[model samples]
Target: MWTASAVLPGAGPADWRELRRDGEAAEFHAATEMLELHGAETEAYLHGLTAEIPSLYVIMRETAGECPLEIVQITASPYEAQDYTDSGEEIVEKVPMPHGLVAWVRDFVEEFHQDEIFVKRKRDKKRIDIVEDGVGDPRIDKAADIYASPSLKRRRLQ
Candidate 1:
């Protein structure tokens, strides 16, 4: 990968203390050295490149309480988690497994729905008192012209 001609090139043998090489090889070595210098950045970039596709990872994080939870990582997953009890918040249970994950989630959701308290939506109960008057006459009084405005009479263009 690294070449000696790159390290020492056509510059000259004048400076014996320091080695001089071809500028092209030096440039190549410099590029490699620059890449190596940002090892962490390069690794992160490569990781991001590989992470273009959606993946599921169970991330365990310490929460307010003393228990660790499985935080699901997904770009997009149709699974929804719901928790309502002495425990605090809902947890993500959706993760790519061999199988039966959907059934487990469905059972969990069913149990949760059975035990969870759902407050009934309060109806507005608004009173709409529509008073009807005597509306017998369907005939309309109109001007000689149909397009005449109430404020300004229709202008006649000759």
Candidate 2:
């Protein structure tokens, strides 16, 4: 998967913004250093990170505020991941970010939102219907179909 990773330096927000928007590719270490010069908050966030998860990627857009940038993280896990592992990243409407970070990201810049990459979910248009070989009772009935229910019965009223 193609990704963009650019660090914002304290020297120039314009350059960082340009790189973020137009650059084909950028490295993290170089970017991290540039951002550190601008804000302690961003520096601290980077310092806290030990390693990057290979499955996820993020594009941090420079905000108008003093902070480094507003970043939106999303998974790049391959389609085949579902075939191998039963447990996979859930289909999420948005990335899960800490409350404090979310607040910070929004505050750092005005109208901060996720920078999305075009990744479409492809599924074969095949209908999955009820198919069975051996069965105890035919479920299709006329009046009512018996579903598993509570055994307790109501008492008769006087």
Candidate 3:
């Protein structure tokens, strides 16, 4: 999987530039691709930003066209990035998050993030431990050893 060396911001449409080629190895620079942030995914964005080394995920897909690879997605949310990794058909790379992009994400998170409150569930007072009503087959009428197998019960009767 190829990693993005850098991100170049642009005001116009997206385009690519050939960097260099060494026979079989070649590099291209893709520009003007925008990374969008959603309010609903603020939690995922927060998890990514708080990591030890915050990063941007680049997902590339292999194509049969003239271009060998195509950029599928560029994501700031690690959770979203993880989804692409599971497919095994796409290439996922971790690129160090740019300072400006990090700040932008932080601003978006600050505006949309909401803390969820935890609620503990209370157990009902039903006394289920006192009885073993369904432990044995209903066909057997014995009360003392309900756990005994049907064969054992038949043997005891004989």
> What lDDT score belongs to each candidate, Candidate 1 first?
0.31, 0.35, 0.80
lDDT of 3: 0.80
What does candidate 2's lDDT look like per residue over 1-158, in tens digits? 22243222233323233333346554333133221112323322332222242222233444567544544333222222233234333222222334444344435433332344789999988877767544333443422434433244569999
* Runs in model 3 lying further than 4 Å from the true structure: 11-16, 21-25, 130-158
Quick one: best TM-score, which candidate? 3
* Clashing residue pairs, backbone N/CA/C < 3 A, model 1: 8-21, 9-21, 9-22
Clashes of each: 3, 2, 0
How accurate locally is residue 42 in candidate 1, as Cα lDDT from 0 to 100? 31
**Which ranking of candidates, highest TM-score first?**
3, 2, 1
Q: Write the per-residue lDDT of candidate 3 for residues 90-144, one digit (tens) a residue.
A: 8888888888888999999999999889899999999987985656776567776
What TM-score does candidate 3 reach?
0.71
Per-residue C-alpha lDDT of model 1 across residues 1-158, encoded as one tens digit per residue? 22212221223333223334575433222111110112223322233223433222222233455323322222112221122212544333323432243343334434433333689999787766866454333342363433443454469899
RMSD per prediction, one decimal?
23.1, 17.6, 6.5
Quote the positional error of residue 77 for candidate 1 in Å: 6.7
Ranking by lDDT: 3, 2, 1
Best candidate according to lDDT: 3
